[model samples]
Target: NVMNVIISKKSGQPTTMKLNGVVSTSYSDSAFKFNKDFAISTDTTTFTLEVTWRMIDAEDGSAYDSTDTNSFKIVRSTRVNQPSEGYLDCWERDLFLQFNGKPINAINETMNKLEVVFTTNSDRYKKVSVDITHKSGSTKDSLLALPLSENDSGFSGFFEREVGAPKRDNVLQHSDPDSIILIYRNPDNPLDTIRKAYPFAISKILKFPAASYFDKNADGKVDSIFIEVEGPVDQEDLEKLKSSITLPEPRKFKVNSISVVKGGIALDVTEQSNEIRTYVSPTDKIIVNSGSLPAGGLIEGNIINVQDKVAPVLLSGTFFSDRQDSLQVEFSEPVKHFSSKEPILFSHGGKTYRVELAENGVFSKERFYTSKVISVESGSAITEGDLIWINPAAGIGDTLGIKQLNPENRRVPLKVQEAEYEITVRTVNNPMKPDKPVPPEVVNVFGEKGKKVPPNGVVIVVEPKGEIKNKIKMDEGKVSIYDVVKHLVKKDIEGVFDEGTQKLYFIWDGTNEKKRVVGTGTYNAVIRATTISQKTNNRKTFSQIVPLGVKRK
Candidate 1:
């Protein structure tokens, strides 16, 4: 028997046959089978196969002819029309494929198996076998593969597989491949096979770099640990990554969240076990068991330095009435900064005053002092028995950023009278001639005998009250007496404070510093008293003028 075959594309108009062949066939057991090899154009969408057969009997010499025509739809080859980049989950040792637009019939009931071969740069190939099952509701255009689980044995007509350990290890050892090939063979014609190559780049390989601990308040405790990586981590893979991190014994941490930073992903972690102690130590090794990262471990970071945990103590507060009436507070240690949510209060005459404290101008290495001038809005004087204390909400931060705790109602030790000194002046005529019995007179008035002296001298008595007895020391050569007798005569006269009488006496002679007696005239004696406190060593000066009339003898 002789047979002829022809194939033509079915379109609006009948086109020429793209393929034609002739073959001789034989029959066995009343059945005839013939095989022919031919090539068809890829652009053909639908084609019709026509076959004509002629048979002749050897004895009768009669010929019989038969013709048959059949139409077949030409489906496109299995190809990766839209292939997305893939990422490797280092913790789970899984490769995630996000490709779409593959032919729906790539894996069907007839051809129920698909093989994806990943060829590395070293020319090593890893074949992934995917067992496909037909689904009723599968779309006709494309097959969307759901994420594959490790236990999934069969999937729908889509490529989904959990890579084996050996093949994954082998593939990871070498560099990533430039492309991957999808192989599918037709069950009807084994010789007709489809192999589609797509650009396959393992865009990101998850890694765990050196981690750092952070102290948000600078209190020498770890608030969070940031783990940087080279790729983006999905939310589903976060738990796996969290489980892969191993901390030293007795130290525990929790991975809170993952965020994208400048370079890569950051894993925010907090200490879960210890609050007082640090979460991690310098010597402790932080190991991340991931397939893509280095197997050695992460680089250890510097340990956080422990700071002074003790809060600053309020030592003493001294009230000063020197140039400005201020209250100075001293602390046990140096203070870096301080602030109060409410006002630092001072009660004077049953009225409250807000005092704002600032850094003291004087520097002391041993301690810290904050000074604030006390001023009442009601003009009430800050006296003894009046309260001066800091608010409870005041925060006095030390050099190590530790704030003072429970400062509320902490009274400052203040002696308002210690800073206050009262001065009274009295003059005596002919003080040099004590036997003459000259009476003492108030320095404010010029009496007949007190004003008209014998031109010898006058005695000025200074009585100071308060804590200025032996602590009054003159600083920087400040003259205590000035006799104005038609000229400025500054006398360097030293006076002794008699503790018994509670008085300081200074005698001014009729002669100036030149030792010459002045002509008979009225002279004014200016007395200045400078007193320094023993507690704070602060100096205060009081001045008084006494007028004396001198007559030449």
Candidate 2:
């Protein structure tokens, strides 16, 4: 008899196998086998066994030959499987095993029990068992043994004890091991048991702090917020963190940047396009969806707070009274350290005046805080086209002690109005007809026709009309009657300025200062009045001259 065993892979190793065995007629019914001491290479899983034998009669040399071939697979060893790494199920808040070669049967709440169903073709093993073990210094300690039961595909069971802790120091602990020892036992031969250990690790979710705040401008309000998290976050984790934030309805925050800060990762939060900077208030609560995070951890909400560090601003200054002597200064917020001695500057008629606040004038009204009605001295009246501004050198401040520094804040252009005046002259008809009516005419002392006047006299009237209700001065020498031919002053008329009527009345009567009628071939009447121009704050003199003709009766 001849027998040959061939290994499927024979590139670099021996393929044929030789066996020492014997077969006899006395044991014709028995099977021939190789010696138990013979060993087969375990480098390959498939092998082929072939046997050839010849039979001959007792008297003849004739022979009958037959060959039989059989193929089979070898069980190398028991293994846990490939891809032994474990993952953190953040949504479930549990450590999940990612096994590629086996199907998961069940997982208990305590995470101590794990059942896996494996498929196999061999029937030599009677039962399967697993040992959950970890290295304790130099020795390996078996935490628990899971004896599996017979199933459709293979054996599956659960461990009786827990495997890992609820939390870990780091998010991923690659150094630690939570491995499984797969064991395959043969009932026929206990010494042929197979056991193998596969090492793996369990990663836990990352946790972050619960409080953050941002005051970029250091103002008394919150400009933005910072949400801290673990560092070295990739783009995928960044998008997840952004979607996990929750704010109140209509109030939204955007992630401006993800940067590595001194402590950890920082998510800078700012306002959206439609939102304002002050959308996040002090002591506001923000919910973080822990399930959406990459790793599993506790849901510690973020608490935001606002801090103030910016000074107040002076907004504008305006004249509150029609007289243009009272200025109202406004501030962006409530201010302090402003008193009656606060030096405020005013620009009027190309001149600068240092003014002070009126008594009890520091008060707030309307929407903004105001230094109400600062009274300018009568001699330095601020009027139309004037300017009033508060300089930073004035040392004004808000309640928080932040000083005002912007010069444009309190600068205001005043629009106070000034008074307007008109002059009219009334002359009598010819002296022969005291009650007769005569036609009125315009006369210019510079050579225009003069208005005919009777010996009785002529009356000059000046009317002041404007927003200003105060009376103007119209004293003697303000209205002068002179002789046009001689170019000499004939008389200085005295006029009465009436505050009630806002008018100045002067009766010339064609007479000289000696109270006598003067010859009036062509007498000139000059009227001069002084007024302050509100635009330039400059004193201006207005003059009007009229020539009169004296008619004989």
Q: Highest lDDT: which candidate?
A: 2
Q: Any runs in candidate 1 off by more than 4 Å, and if so which? A: 1-316, 319-419, 430-456, 465-486, 534-538
TM-score of structure candidate 2 = 0.37
How well is each residue in 391-500 modelled by candidate 1, as lDDT tens digits? Answer: 54666555666664544434554555354457777776643442333334322122321443333356667766555533454322222334453457646554444444
TM-score result, candidate 1: 0.31
Give Cα distance to truth, residue 392, candidate 2, Å.
Answer: 7.6
Q: lDDT by residue for model 2 over 418-498, one digit each (tens)?
A: 444444544444231323432232122101223333334555666544435444544322677677655655545655554
- Model 1 Cα displacement at 248 (Å)? 32
Q: What's each prediction's TM-score? A: 0.31, 0.37
Measured with C-alpha atoms, the lDDT of residue 275 in candidate 2 is 24
Report every candidate's CA lDDT.
Answer: 0.45, 0.47
Total clashing pairs for each candidate: 0, 5
lDDT score for candidate 1 against the true structure:
0.45
Q: Look at candidate 1 and tell me the lDDT of residue 263.
A: 58
**Candidate 2 stretches greater than 4 Å from native:** 1-223, 228-236, 248-258, 263-283, 295-299, 302-361, 365-368, 372-553
